[model samples]
Target: MSSVSTRASFTAPALALVINAFVWGTSWWPFRQLEARGLHPLWATVLIYAVAVLVILALRPRALGQLLRTPVLWILVLASGTTNAAFNWAVTLGDVVRVVLLFYLMPLWAVLLARLVLREPLTHHAAARVLLALAGAAVVLWPAGRSGWEALPLPRTLPDWLGVLGGFCFALNNVMLRREAHRPEEARALAMFVGGMAVAGTLALVLVGNGMASPPPAPAPGWVAGVAAMALLFLAGNLALQYGAARLPANVTSVVMLTEILFASISALALGGGHLDGQLLGGGALILAAALLSTLSGADAH
Candidate 1:
């Protein structure tokens, strides 16, 4: 009887993480669809997160006060906000697989950030993982039919840059979550939700003001429905993430979250939003290998 209860407790959190992964993995399709309907991804992020924020506030109004009073949570707000804004925009404008692969570089950034923020020692194993991940990134960024400095493995497109940026911020967000795990869960959730809305909303307004991007089209059933659905989905996913991440070791959380890559890859390929090739497969394998190693090492460390 005790064993059964223990297993249930363990399984529930792991499954919750999987739920979060699935929501994000398939989110690109909806973002793209909304974009087609004249809703920019930034604007869509604002609306989706706005709904989520309202729901959270309705249920736990004190979360807003907690987030505001806790100075450390402000870091979480910026990190989570930047992660969603950058990733959503990048995935919408870039090859889904490539963008995802780039974003999954989170592990590399995680290793570094954990060391810096958590004061985790930079062990030899961690260093090796970093090198492996860097090699994988180079392979992924390697250009075809180019040579010398011109072919340097660097981000050449806007989507590529955004992917890298999002990955870094996501790493920071995860580290901050672990750091502040003792905080009230609702406060953390509120911070993340608010970040998404604030960052995306500010960017959208800036772009619209400068005529760099079109404003959100007048409300229509198509985008309205999409935004509403996404709001609920993201809210659920965020809550699951908070619950699961808080309960599990960060390394274990990372391993489970890798399913996001598989989900994104399959969905994008099936829907024609992405393609596969030798270079990508090879590089992706290397990157994932490094990430797996990093997680295992982190678990062992703890």
Candidate 2:
């Protein structure tokens, strides 16, 4: 018989990462939907991850102890929480395509973070992979000719900058996960869940104080129900991410996870009536091709 089952050990985590991608890809809609009902994205994140924190603590009451012993997990809490806060706010306030294009720049961040944190050597294959990923991002993010080629490739608006910030935080979060893979998974999960609550909750308080963002409105039954549903989805996605990311090399997980862009693109097109013009189609193919090459090369440095 073939060793097909043996091969599955690696392949399965790749598939799990894809599942995580789908959850995140379409996640913006629920945030925006909840926002429409007077729940700000920060508040929505607070509610969703708050539920996640409670659930995790209930299951593993001692999980917090491990995080206390490992100070690095606190960095994870900051990274993961800031990531959600940035992306959720950016997407709700800006064009989905633009925000996603900037956010998916995680591969660029990943290359450097992996080398720095995991001490993974940047092989020639990985160098080439990062270059290709950047090229694809250029294709997708290049400003229209309306700007007459003088436009900087940098993010201009507040939301665009938030997307970039979110990508950096995401890269750090993933790197931390790889570094802490030896620790109890429950501690890692608990740290991330609590980070969401702490970061978003703190920011929400600032905005409310400054009169920029509102408090969690009087909870209408409909919105409360929606928050509960989104929380459950977030919890599931978190578990899937832990399963895949903890098993795979950090860089490989980052590369495979770019499929989230594809998921986001399709969902945006369908829900927002976005037109799939030629440039978008071509750019997406380039991005996907780069990810495929990374998988085949398997330039996964530990």
Per-residue error for 45 in candidate 2, Å, reads 0.4
Q: Write the per-residue lDDT of candidate 2 for residues 102-138, one digit (tens) a residue.
A: 6766656777888888888987866876777677666
Q: Estimate each model's TM-score.
A: 0.94, 0.84
Most lDDT-accurate candidate? 1
Model 1, span 1-302: residue lDDT tens: 99999889889999999999999999999999999999999999999999989998999999989998999999998999999999999989999999999998877888899888999888888888888889989999999999888799999999999999999999899889879989998998899889999999998899999998999899999999999999999878978987897788877887998999999999999999899799999989988998899778873221
- Alpha-carbon shift of residue 23 in model 2 (angstroms): 2.2
| Sequence-dependent TM-score of model 2 | 0.84
Q: Which pairs clash in model 1?
A: none
